[model samples]
Target: MPTESFDERFTGPTLNQDLWVDHYLPQWSEPARSRARYDFTTDGLRLRIDADQMPWRDADGSFRVSNLQTGTFSGAVGTTRGTHRHRLDGLLVETPQVTRRLWTPSSGELEVVVSASADPTCMLAIWLVGFEESGPEDSGELCVTELFGDRIGPLSSTVRVGIKAHHDPRLTDDVRDIELPIDATKPHAYGVRWSGDGVDFTVDGQVIMSSPQQLAYEQQLMIDLFEFPATEQREPRNYPKTAMVHSVAGTSAS
Candidate 1:
């Protein structure tokens, strides 16, 4: 087993002042709450969430809650690529704007809404990854999705997402598949409900996909926005990127 240690005393700032870090980050055991400073530690990563700067949402459903500009390098890698030596676990969530606040549910269903803007290229994704092992030949850790991963691009000039299953080329005994939904162009909402049986995925308040093999109970949820400049090929089209979230929560409607 890998030894994991956390720094409870650590507190940092967000990239902005209005967007402060929610110190009581329920994601990690020790460093639950964080400011702007963020780092990866085994099963979890650190991030700052601004409640005041985000959209308003009360129990009455009078206001909508959004996490804009709130950012966090969840999972094993940050915005910048580096050496792939560690195998981190859990879900990651983030936003590109500084006006919305990401909300974490306690025991209800988990929903992710992406409001479309002029930059139709803005893409939002909710991904899940099981594990990463040493790669073959010259490649590094072998990513499972390379075999079964499929893409569901923008649905009606609005969004696109995909799900993939991984079968370790080296170990035939290891195999798992996960499906994810996304929206990039049109304003839409996605959600997932988890229980003992499996996970149910929904889009625009409608159920779309379900997976029996899920890790929602044991991990955390991560939401993120791809904000880097679009590449030459990505200029006209919004090419989506896949992320592996470690944890998932909630109960299925069925």
Candidate 2:
């Protein structure tokens, strides 16, 4: 297979309008809230989770998150299409689903050069979520890389990679945490290649994770950095929680 070159960088002192949208949920109207802000930088896109910021849309004054998607699918979080609960033999079963018209590549490679957050309370994720409103079988997630600052050790950190079956029958939802040679807080390239049969994940072009099942339907790219505030179950820290993205590039067989 040949490489299909696709590059998206944070240029011109701002995010490129043609390549991205601000969010995944439609309820987040204008004058948004939270501490997740996206802007351009000399290195790339700067996604910061400011704990001191206030809420923008919903009154849920909790942690701030910046969720951007390659496609605008459903309006609400997940699928609130209808009250999918009914009584069958005096038992209520709820089916939450929605359909999304998203852009997905059948066989391609996507790479992100990112500097993970250093804040112990913040986290970063690079993954592909299915536009699963089509059916329950369409619900699957391809998590190429996910890391929390607290997981980092003095030498290396564990990078979480895998596939979640969700409601999909085609996947086993197998995932693993692989130790790398460098610090995750520094910039590194995380990539994934899907070729109908399976998926292979790479770090700096070196394979680290793989899956045999395939999801050939519509999907979208979701990369974000966010922080969760302290609660009764969790503690707070002073780590500068933020994600610095240097670039996002893709390739496919041509």
Candidate 3:
């Protein structure tokens, strides 16, 4: 087994503020709007998106999200510099973030014990994204696991795992979706063992996918629960949609 650097069980009366920031891309959306709606219970961290919750970034679209990140850093406000800038048009920072790096490992084995909500409009994802402190080209992502509720079945689900190049030119997108015999609404361990050689994606201690592309930059963990807007076929309801995280553990490469 790899030597563990940290293990967070969420056995808390409150969240460990020193290790996590309960917001999703606050630099682009502002803290009040990006703040996550979550709580800790015997089941661990329960991230939820209520029916009445406002969209994360109104300019982006009508989607709401609750998330936690191990680190955050960005340039001055109004500057187009921040982690995970998805649009090519550029994203101005709404608020400058004080650099925080609770855990940023260059190469590691990171895992999360998690379960997704059954609502088709919701999605649960755990990923490691570049801190982008070294350079904008470092903003790649290693998607540990991504499960959309619509892809989930009673006894099987389509799990997405791989690398996202984003702004990182050295990397190419290699994401893939594989059908697995498992109930996504139930607890499962999703993980990734990454190094300069490549990355291996795993589920329930078993390797599900492997890639030859290398991502050697420092990366931070990001856990998110998203709720898409109501479509013509699916209307919004008052029921709360939630994703539960039983634990998160990581072992840095020696």
Best by TM-score: 3
Clash number for model 2? 6
Total clashing pairs for each candidate:
35, 6, 0
Residue 84 lDDT in candidate 3 = 82
Query: Residue by residue across 207-240, what tens digits does model 2's lDDT show?
Result: 9977788877655677877666665233235433
Off by over 4 Å in 2: 1-5, 27-36, 52-61, 75-79, 82-103, 232-240, 252-254
lDDT of 1 by residue, 46-127 (tens): 2222222211212212221112222122333222111111223432222221212222212135554433333322233454
- lDDT per residue (tens digit) for residues 1-254 in model 3: 21238889999888888788899988899777799998888889899987667788888888889999988889998898887887857579998898888888889899899998877889999989998988899989999999999999889999999999999999999999999999999999999999878899999999999998988988879999999866623334654789999999998784
What ordering of candidates by lDDT runs from best to worst? 3, 2, 1
Indicate which candidate wins on lDDT: 3
TM-score of 1: 0.35
Our model 3 lands, by Cα RMSD against the true structure, at 2.7
TM-score of each: 0.35, 0.78, 0.95
